[model samples]
Target: MTPTSSDTTASPDVSGVVPPTVTAFDGNGDVDPDATAAHAQFVVDGGANAVFPLGTNGEFALLTAGERRRVVEAVTDAVDVPVIAGVGAPSTRETVANAEHAASVGVDGVVVVTPYYYPLDEEGAVAHYRSVAAAVDVPVYVYHIPSKTGNELSLETLGRIAALDGVAGLKDSSKDVPWLAQAIDANPDMDFLVGSDSLLFAGLELGCTGLVSAVANVFPELVVDLYDAYAAGDEDEAQRLQSTVFDVRSAMKRGPYMAGVKTALSLRETDFDVGGLRAPLRTMDDAQRAALETDLRELGVL
Candidate 1:
């Protein structure tokens, strides 16, 4: 399904288990748009409410500008769900350009991570988001993953960003419950997506409307069930699923950073082959793959 042109004034509903999908690659380390789109479709078919491409899982930092744009285009064309492309770069100019490209391709919205490498002051962070939000007509969701970007956004900066014209919400992976709760309380109207699998239930309880789960890329049904149970007011079921997710998360972390999802996908019954992570980011070795498979089997996820 082709994505329709984005509506600038209305914020797209990004609430639910949205997978920050991995970018599929061919053997030569080239981006494979078809395989990437198929992975996106796979998650959506597994009951994911939406899909996010070019995120951390997508290895956004490694891809060239052209590769990033192609992934966005392919994923948007493959699924009828909201596609929120990750358009983050270290520089505001590059980020704005990425966002503009994403919007031009008909994404529902864009997720902008905090500028990395150089530490940014609160004012700089706010101004960066302001410029990105102003450049595109689509709603902009702030991506706050400090561990990766090396730039942390404070509550004051977030409040200012939330007030921007086309700013829609935030996806917080900081894992700071107090900070997340305070942010939610402060911005009653802005949507919040819990970006860590460990805090999905907690995030929902703290008033977050959505989840941007890396676990969802491999086990979309598990995350979706958790969300549905909570929405259905079945706290017990949600908690049980959350426990299950913890197990799954542990098993997926058996390999190198960001390797588990793709490895698990290859091990699934469907035997999906999205290829290995691009160089510098290694794939699971033989031993790691064996261990991961055994763990998944014990958990009955494989």
Candidate 2:
């Protein structure tokens, strides 16, 4: 009996985990394990309730399959935090394999994105996630960011996956706020994280549980502060901080998501250059770096 998109009793017991944006590095375009650990600790110390390794912001699409596995393991080993592995690929087999690996490595959960670079329609996306979730034992977070992947996890698709046993959450990165509201109300059981930091304050104000933001990698404390404040009815402080956070969020628009985040970290510290975009993405230019700095300095973040 194929399950309809109405069931939600079997979802995992994950209540308040802020799947943090991850960092990448290497001496020769490889997974630098130590830096990985350091970055994991950075988020943990900054107060991320959990970590989401190999996310799009982690440049998962750019890394090799083996490197992805290493990252999932590195982050899980680095912190006492629960790691939700982002195990999405262009094919079901690969996604399932990654999910199985995440479960094998003992990650707390797996966040699965829709398979990009393919004409995956609603039915396909639904099937892809269901198969991936069934292959692993941990909870699964359905990643919905259409801008980069060329695929959007529609409310119908999201509901279907949420109905499944292992699909426990949805990472809504779209700019559409109404559907996000719909998704939250639609799946009262599954955790729906605000995948966009710019909307984090407003999203939480409306009832979002947490955020899976890329910018969180740069200013985790600020992000966590908002989460804590909003949850505790500190609307006065949340609005004030949200306005100031724009400087950092604005600079991120200057380049690719991961590159922009890495650049921000580089500007703030002496020991954090993870090197260029994996490949195809040429290294950021001097002018671009200057622009990023300008934004950071304005925010007083640098």
Candidate 3:
């Protein structure tokens, strides 16, 4: 359906037609709103239509619920841009609390990942999302990334939430473009986005409404260029840019994604620090640093 006009024009499901997402960090690894705001404006200035402040790259898992709220406040107030905060956590109660906090802070929407740490059955997962959706008035977009959460959102769950008024969208970051495309196409009213840059070449062509690509955090212009190219029907140009994005996205698998991302920001020495990573994860050594630097140099990120 097209957007209605009072002499009007159509608009997409989410606030941003092309969202350039970033991971915000403080000097001591704590969540800092001011730094987040600065990073967000940088993305906005790069021509990204929207800014998603906290996601996997933001290290949402490690951040306390209170810290997440602070980030939501920081990024939303930082720019006139739309901020979608990640509210997914282990328990429905905690997630709902975070969602409520997000609503109180005035974010455009909340991105809730599926239930993790318990491997809930389909019914339990459905109940988890429904609980959060019930608590808040804003749009609730489901995050379907089984890789990190160990809990998957089946297509069946997607269909159930698609019928809800408050459940407006889904960001399937599983890196499975075909499945995400299918899940989203099943419900036209639900805004669908693939949270990866690797398959963006085929993804945009399949009807995704926006992108929450982590790579976009490093190269906002390149991501926006791909989106603009497609909107202009310049598929060839978009693909070329998207291919470069996919190559860079390979860093996630080579080692720790957060380290590489934070390292890249640290390389800029722009005073934006993700706070030295949490346990089970360590800082980068000189060799890893050199490897990333070499790659960033090739990608022109450094």
Off by over 4 Å in 2: 1-20, 255-257, 270-272
Candidate 2 on 1-302: residue-level lDDT in tens? 11224443344333333645554667577777668767878877888877788876678888888988888888888888777888888899999998898899888778888888887887898888879877876777888888888888778877777777777777778879998898888877767778776888878865677777677787778878777887788998887777767767878678654567777777768365555567765555788889989877878766
Winner on lDDT between 1 and 2 is: 1
For model 3, residues 9-105, the per-residue Cα lDDT tens digits are: 2223453334434545555656667777777776777777777666777677777767777878888888776677788888888899989998898
For residue 42, give model 2's deviation from the true position in Å.
0.7
Lowest-sum lDDT 10-residue window in model 2: 1-10
- The clash count of every prediction, one per candidate, is 0, 0, 2
List the RMSD of every prediction in angstroms.
Answer: 3.1, 3.4, 3.5
Of the pair 2 and 3, which is ahead by TM-score? 2
TM-scores, each model vs. reference: 0.96, 0.90, 0.89
Candidate 3 segments exceeding 4 Å error: 1-27, 251-253, 269-275
**Top model number, lDDT:** 1
| Per-residue lDDT of model 1, residues 1-302, tens digit only | 21122323877878898899999999889999999999999999999999999999999999999999999999999999999999999999999999999999899999999999999999899899989988998889999999888998889888888878888888999999999999999988788899999999999999998999998999899999999999999999999999999999989998699899999999885535699999899999999999999999999887
Q: For model 1, state the Cα shift of residue 248 in Å.
A: 0.5
Instruction: List per-prediction Cα lDDT, in the order shown.
Output: 0.91, 0.75, 0.72
